[model samples]
Target: MKHLTILVPDAQTSLNTFACIIGAYDIFTRANQHWVGQGKDPVFTVCLAGVSENAVIQQDIMSIRPEFRLSQVAGTNLILIPAISLDFERPEGGNIELTGWIREQYNKGAEVASMCSGGLMLASTGLLDGKSCSIHWNAVDKLKNLFPRVLVKTERLITDAEGIYTNGGGYSFLNLVLYLVEKYYNRETAIYCSKIYQIEIDRQNQSAFTIFTGQKAHGDEVIRKAQAFIEDHFREKISVQDLSTRFAVGRRNFDRRFIKATGNTPVEYVQRVKVESAKKSLESTRKTISEVMYEVGYADVKAFREVFRRITGMSPLEYKNKYNKEGADLAAMS
Candidate 1:
């Protein structure tokens, strides 16, 4: 049987962390039971392993205690890291031994998977260096800042690189769990669990759920002013040249600084601001796609649709249909 060790982190973790740990354990255990019920041997031996035997994580009003400590596990086929708190500095500072242990396990040929913000912990192991990783979209900027060597794919729902798996934000980690089920078991078993847990299988991206709040924490006064200008006039035709001239910076220098600070080009930033505005209108107002597009200063229908889909993984209409309750209700009746 494959040995699956879910790391019970000894740090201030989010409430979702507990859910991810219990949820994964329950699903994997169910998978084993399903196999046993089918006259087959169980596939995995699952256990929750922590840094220390006495480690107890308290979040809000609840507590979690792992069944085994990391030192006791001589070897394991797989290691799972669940979402921890977003105050990554605190966890990284406190969980030095945990990260070191994860590194050792990975070096010993064990597969590691991180759920949601757990990517921060896995990335700390240096196993994800130069490898693609997906985390909660909201934490993308922070992860990028902390681990510049790691390729953070904010759009992907799941990233599998050389046995290191990472997933997107929130309860979307359930999708990654289902993916692990299919990988370790079979498609039939994965489908069975998906039905049992009511999780939508084969979700490939988390872009639709992302709210494009631009990264402004970088201390670049000029870039910050430029960002504010873009946000203030997103409904106007703002060009890179115009922005550069207005800011009194050279074109190349402006582009470089903008990208370094915001992780987006001036044009890209402008598009995102406009699209975000359009999204709000679509969600809250009784407006046609054309009206919303024009309101966001998108004169070209094709251009607007393409950019919207590229950023959000959904067309304007699809986004509206998904997020706008009134529109969905009307469509249902129609």
Candidate 2:
């Protein structure tokens, strides 16, 4: 039997944390039972482990008693960390002790998987350094700022580097668990579990759900002014050279500063601003795709569609259909 450890973090309560722990336990147990029904022994020995005996989630909210404490855990085949909290308050003594144990367990040949914001915890162990990880889009900027060594991929739903696995945001951790089931058990069992749980199988992208907001938290005055200019004039064809000249900075220096301050090149920032504005227009107005394209300074249909898809993971029409209120009302009438 493969030993699986589901870690219950000792921190403030989160719905994802509770749901992930129970969901993982329930699914794995059911999967093992499926094998038992097939005239075979159970395949997994799952344990809920934590640093404390009973983790107090919140005041009078809920408390969970882990099956095993960190000290009681001998050797685990796989370790799963659920999403803890978006605003993590590093415990009184810090999570150094917990992270140390995680590192030691990995060094002893156990694989690790982090779900959603749990990637933040897993990255704390330093295992995700020099590795690509998929974190929730909401936390991507914070993760990048906090852990510069970790490569945060916003578009990917799942990232598997060696034995370390990280998944995208929200309750989509179910998909990650299904993916692990396929790896540990078999394709047939994974499919069966997926059907039983009503989870869509083989989902690979979370880009469709991401909201693109240009990062503007840097202290660069000139770059901030440039960002404001782009936002205000996104409907026009604003050139990078013009921005550099207006700011009295060289083109190359301007590009470098823009990238450093905003994590996007001047051209990319302008395109994002335009696309974001176009998104608003698509959702609120009944403007035709061509009209919206023209409003965003894109005269060519092909160029507009390509850039819209590249940034929003959907074509102009698809985005409109998905988010437009008028489209929804019309569909309801139909």
Candidate 3:
């Protein structure tokens, strides 16, 4: 219920990810309207400044400049770095002026937080010298080598720290913001905010005890194409040869890349996705199991039922009963 300004790197910058975060949180707050300037309850005022950087590590990007910069930021309860490209060479050397401004605000009692590479900018400010922070797993080694004084904690997300907070990566970025809203507002507010925006917030921490479950391997463009194709054709039986030809990659290379990047082979991943789609259908639709199965890539009822049982540990009918039925046994678990 307090107005806040998110100072983004100036315009002409490559990507305004943080500004998007500001806009997203504002929308998530259910503040009655898109936050305009200087309103009574301005949940977020995006200050788009110059100094563009890489949006993601998927490509080799050249940093750009912005048309405006933060003249002065004060009286805000929080400062957030959505993402910053802090590299191995002189990681703490770049972004001097911006980091200094953040430090000045934090000294004035504002809580500083960053998501993904944004922690690099915060680390450059020395705010995380003795503090613990979570960073994108890919940059774990570089970050540690760059800043030995900082205590790096790798997990789903990190917060409730004394002076700062950090999240693991882009997906966890939403979790970080939701956690902030929940801390200042309430759990209901956070949930309502997510629901109103139709954002599938991170309900469970992905970086849990399952070792190698989330250990991110190197990025691969071939796998990206396969994923795109899978998302597009979940209703049909997608073939490995078809994907290989469509993406202009060999079947072996495509399979290797997909498995390396997503931690699941193409076939296995598709099977899981098909089952998930069927689960939603069972919950939200009045269709028969055979129809739902065909709708989600499986044509045989028995095969779909078997996959569902193996993955969810429940048959189709049992899952539907537990989910759609009122006060079904193990309803709490459902």
Per lDDT, the best of the predicted structures is 1
Better of 1 and 2 by lDDT: 1
Give the poorly placed runs of model 1, Cα more than 4 Å off.
90-94
Q: Which of the two candidates, 2 or 3, achieves a greater lDDT against the reference?
A: 2
Residue pairs in clash, model 2: none
Q: RMSD in angstroms, all models?
A: 1.1, 2.3, 11.6
RMSD (CA, angstroms), candidate 3: 11.6
Candidate 2 lDDT by residue in tens digits, 180-200: 999998999999999999999
lDDT order, best first, reads 1, 2, 3
- How much lDDT does each candidate structure score? 0.91, 0.86, 0.62
Model 3: which ten-residue window has the lowest total lDDT? 206-215
- Per-model TM-score, in order, reads 0.98, 0.91, 0.51
Report the error of model 3 at residue 52, Å: 12
Candidate 2, run of 10 with poorest lDDT: 88-97
TM-score of model 3 relative to the true fold?
0.51
Ranking of models by TM-score: 1, 2, 3
